[model samples]
Target: MKFTKLTSSVLAGATLLSIMAPTASFAATSKAGSADAKTNDNGGTKLPQNDHTEVGISFGDNNSNGNTGYLRLQAVPHTLDFGNHKLLDDSKLDFTADGKNTSLSVNNTKGSFNGTNANQTTTLATGTDTALDTVKGTAWATVVDKQVTRIDPMNGPEDTSDPTNPKPTSGFHKGTDSVAGTWTLSVQATSPLTAVDNGDPSKEIVDENGAKEEIKDAKLTFSDTQYAQTQNVLGLTKDKNDNTYAKDLADLTKQPTVAPVKEITKNVSTPLVANGSDITVAKAAAGEGQGANVFGWLPENIKLTMPAGAAVSNAIYKANLTWTLNSTVA
Candidate 1:
């Protein structure tokens, strides 16, 4: 499940107008003389007028003047469906799978244009079980979530969202400031894989002879692999001595990586930090647009090792994974 909320405040600022001076008019009349008589008279003064009385602008949390800033994160592959695993008995059995097989992604949006922290730290927490399991179903393993060490983002050349480009999504401009800052994300699985028998109506695990059983001796571990597009693409380049200038979004060296795989157990918190990742996910210059999507694929490696004396249930197994992305930086 996902939840989100944002707080916005309009920093109404004062607008100043320099007052202008009043205009004056005068006419002079001189007494009649023999040949060179003249007359002059003076009229009062007229005050200057202004059309506007108030001058104010709105701003956000960052160095924004009459602009807005925001941070957003969304889970990719909303559901991690590890499909179809066969049952094994007595001897230990194992199954290994990848996250990419399920199509995983984490979409993020950060900007200092309106807020100061263009960079955010993301963390994951395990949550509830799925509908396929009983209310008090026992988890198959002590640990469930794991990740590899942080890896560079697949910093392919800036794309024009062209179908011909590898992993194409969007493009970066030459003058706009790409989203600058480092952000990290973590993934978590709250429950264990439970096998529901094909004959049982409650979706409970069953023995060969047909007795309900809970396979608590099974261990499920998670892993990940990071990849980048390496074909004909446009990349952002920068001067090594200068930080303020870049050729385009592809010019920046934003990269993301998967940290070493972690072993997740029930009730034990396994925190996966983005150790060496950068903004290669997507690049944005100021005012290019809102929420430019930087798309990348994550291949998850899942291994299920069953202990000896495990039940032999010939049915499909299922589990729930909760991927949480936090903005709290440590």
Candidate 2:
């Protein structure tokens, strides 16, 4: 019975070994299949998956946008009116006036009366009618208001009118991006003062002998010149005492400030000569005078002077003036 039992135990052990061997072989085959799958995935071919798009832009003159990258002269005076006067005598008469008032009048005449009859009382009339042996005259000039600008091509224009955009303030802040360069404002008289007959627009005023009358030595003076920025980049501030001052906030030595419009002939009487050299009224040097600037003279400071002898007839004398703006990098 012991031998039979031993033999049966051995057979059971053999059956268990056969089952374990089959299970081990199946596990090894499954692992190999998994390895092959991983290898195939890593080596799988890939096709290119790329795409493309495009972008574009354009520029133009749009007034609402507040033209940027430009140095511009925005405003100027249109007329300098020298009021009416009388030629009572042949003595040299000087007529000084402004955009509003006049220095010489019927009662306030300047210079000595060189008439042969010193005691002769002459009736001074204030109308367009030509009195006996008396002359009524008016002097005026047509001034052209030139608006000039220089644009930079390197940068796109900015819309300064937008509230969200940065602007030049009163304090010492970083300067706004602009077309940085040099510029000048100049004036010239294109023609001499010529007297025209009031009765006929096409005819010139002539003397008793029909000689064409002209004022060759006529002069126009501009003073108290001032400048302003359209954007109000630099503004005025009042102190405790109510004294006004320029609000300039720049450490001039370090970074360039938006330069103030400088009057080259400030407080000086600049002559307006016909067909003469250009007179620079205001100027901005390199790294200065950015944005829109305007140059103007005080009404009280604008004066026109002419010799009394030039008032030969009862007529209106007219002249032409041209303003110029120049922009440069140097």
Q: Which candidate is the best by lDDT?
A: 2
**Deviation from native of the Cα of residue 167 in model 1, angstroms:** 46
- Residue 268's lDDT in candidate 1: 21
What is the Cα-based TM-score of model 2?
0.46
lDDT of 2 at 251: 17
Where model 2 places Cα greater than 4 Å from the true spot, the runs are: 1-69, 88-92, 96-103, 107-178, 199-212, 230-257, 267-273
RMSD list, candidates in order:
26.6, 32.1
Q: What is the alpha-carbon lDDT of model 2 when measured against the actual structure?
A: 0.44
lDDT of 2 by residue, 62-152 (tens): 1121222233333344444455444523443444343222433453332212212221111111133222111111111111111122212
Report every candidate's CA lDDT: 0.30, 0.44
Off by over 4 Å in 1: 1-71, 78-86, 89-92, 98-179, 196-213, 227-300
- Give lDDT tens digits, candidate 1, residues 1-330: 122222212212211122343556874432232223231221222223236688877321112122112322322333223333323434425443321112111211112111223311111211232221221111111111111111234435655666676463333222222332223334454444555655552375656898644455455454332222111111111112112222332343553232321211212222212221221222222222122122222212444455666555545455444443333223
List pairs with backbone clashes in candidate 2.
Answer: 93-308, 172-249
